[model samples]
Target: MTVTTDTARLPLLLTTLLLPTVARLWPAIGATADAEGWPAAKTLATLLEHEVAERASRRIQRHLIEARLPSGKTLDTFDFAAVPMVSRARIAALAEGDSWLAKGTNILCFGPPGVGKTHLSSALGHALIDAGYRVLFTRTTDLVQHLQTARQELKLASAIEKLDKYHLLVLDDLSYVQKSQAETSVLFELISARYERRSLFITANQPFGAWDSVFPDPAMTVAAIDRLVHHAIILEMNTDSYRRKSAQARAVTSDPGTTAHPN
Candidate 1:
């Protein structure tokens, strides 16, 4: 069955196979590419542009959805009206590119749990990612544990280097547990190495005064906080727990078909 010399349709066949690669942007320039006959150079250029746009869109979605905020709320969805009136200058300062955000300035977010601390930091992280900055989100406990494990494997410096690649790093739940002596020392090293190289966003339930209890060593704790707070915008979230309202809303609207647990 070695039939047919339809060289006329060879280019059209190629375009059909490549159209699916730009499926998201179909019917615009993609549809033009799929039409019969050898495609003009402009059509190929359009396909390339479509592919680039699709890739960027996918990356943006990954950055937004993979953002690890357990509260299931986002900055846009949160009630900023309840947000405290801080200095307008501080808010504006975040928009600027300084050695801190560029070189990775350490940012410390401290307040009680459920006061939108994580939300704000995560939002800032999201914005940074959108602005073409590499960002990573992790819980402080998990980060410290990873560092400990890396030390056991004698790869701590390499692990820290991996983390340092991100332009912005967000660590949530800083008050969950106090760092061990070794963990604290490793954390100090991370703070020093990234002192002005990369920016860090940390959400903590404890205030700066009680931070010594977490680090335990007065001098190192002060140094860590000092590096973190330099040129940082401290947003003290003093609002009541929005989680309570969300929980109450869920309780009132719970499924009628579900039975309550019996004692």
Candidate 2:
């Protein structure tokens, strides 16, 4: 159907009037009310959409964790906003090839127990997953125990290989339990295999100097430390215990149904 210029402009006028509906139909396109706002908003919105898509893609990456740790948790449940220093920029940087995740480097979150070291490490694992990296989370004790079992079944090498497959491996509670000679050997072998080929995220109550105690063999300790710390980011998180603080807060705020004792 052929229409005059004036009549054609009428439909354009209708579309302009119905721009809100148009915007709703294509939210990704980011149509704004103001003519000047639409261009800039569209560009910014496109970038934001790409960023969210990349994040969502990483979130779907497969991850597994040993369940023995009482508070074992995934990055999915982590509260990134609650962590003051964990910015998206840091997460993004780590996701890049030059960072720990890409370089197969180790990330050590060393501090006292009950702090958010595990949480922060798990959150980074989650962020790396969002960036399309495979991650595994496990307590050091649980992992050693599993490897011990794997050794009995003559699958120790297989288990270690499985761990190496992950782009990033998270070993939480590294110093919580003492290691057996066999467990330490197995762990050292695992770390050695992944050296320069994958990344590790470890949370330990003990400092680097104290880690030697975990590895009884002096030579093995040196070797493990060399591989683990060659390209490492040590996040010395010194925050107060979240669990203790929360418990204190709960004690201060008595439950309405419970009877309170006299102070």
Candidate 3:
């Protein structure tokens, strides 16, 4: 009788339209009300609010995994004071979706390996992701190979088109792409296709002047540099290698008890 009464109280259209999770909330709501002396309606509201938050958290987790971002690197964990030259204000502004993103500005991180370039790039991608943007992270070699295979399979255009869905693409370790015309062409095509339409976050181990050995043709190298730098924010990670420091610290901390005197 109570069930029938409750069913009758809900409009037919509304009952049909109700989400499964919302419908499932009734039992939990009733338990909460009985245990805590909350009004059933208030309990329902609280539970539903929690359900929305949990679902959003799960969605964020899934997006992060799908993004293929390198692990353990976020703005919170980054040692920003260690690299004071990277303008925190500028990066924070960029992460907040300022005019640069909408206007297709790129981010180029130029530094030697092990200097936290990848860490900063991945951390920035996470910030953009938190702001509800779609981002993809891939190594330059892996992405180039994938695109080359797409070209061989005669689906290069469609492949490039599919990549357009992502708001930003983080191409890590750009210096590792072998110095061959085919690889360079594939990579150039990708850069050209996204020009002024989407943003790129590129990490390289060399400065722009040193990129000629990587690109097969001088003209292509010049063109690529021009396009990438037109509206770019260059973050020069000119710091000592954190990896080397960490290793040295560990070695010092674990020194053997016997120190040899001049023998």
Stretches of candidate 2 off by over 4 Å are 1-89, 95-99, 180-182, 255-263
lDDT score, residue 47, model 2? 48
Candidate 2 Cα deviation (angstroms), residue 263: 12
Global lDDT of each candidate: 0.69, 0.68, 0.82
Tens-digit lDDT string for candidate 1 (1-263): 89986756645664687644445444456455666543677776776676777767777777665655444434455456556644435644564445557756567776667767776776666656666566778888888888888888999999999876677778888777585535556777777778777777888888888788667489988998888887575667766776776776687689656666889
lDDT of 3 by residue, 1-263 (tens): 35445554444533586544555665666676888899767876876786677667776788798889988898888878767888888778888875777878899998877888888888888998888777899999888889889999999999998888778899999987866736567778888888998899999998888888767788999998899999888999888887888897788779956465896
Which stretches in model 1 have alpha-carbon errors above 4 Å? 1-41, 61-72, 86-100, 180-182, 245-263
For model 2 the local lDDT of residue 150 reads 91
Q: RMSD of model 1, in Å?
A: 7.2
Superposed by TM-score, candidate 2 places the C-alpha of residue 152 at a distance from the truth, in angstroms, of 3.0
Error of 1 at 58 (Å): 3.2
State residue 137's C-alpha deviation in candidate 1, in Å. Answer: 1.4
Candidate 1, after superposition: displacement of residue 219 in Å?
1.2
TM-score head-to-head 1 vs 2, winner: 1
Number of the candidate with higher TM-score, 1 or 3: 3
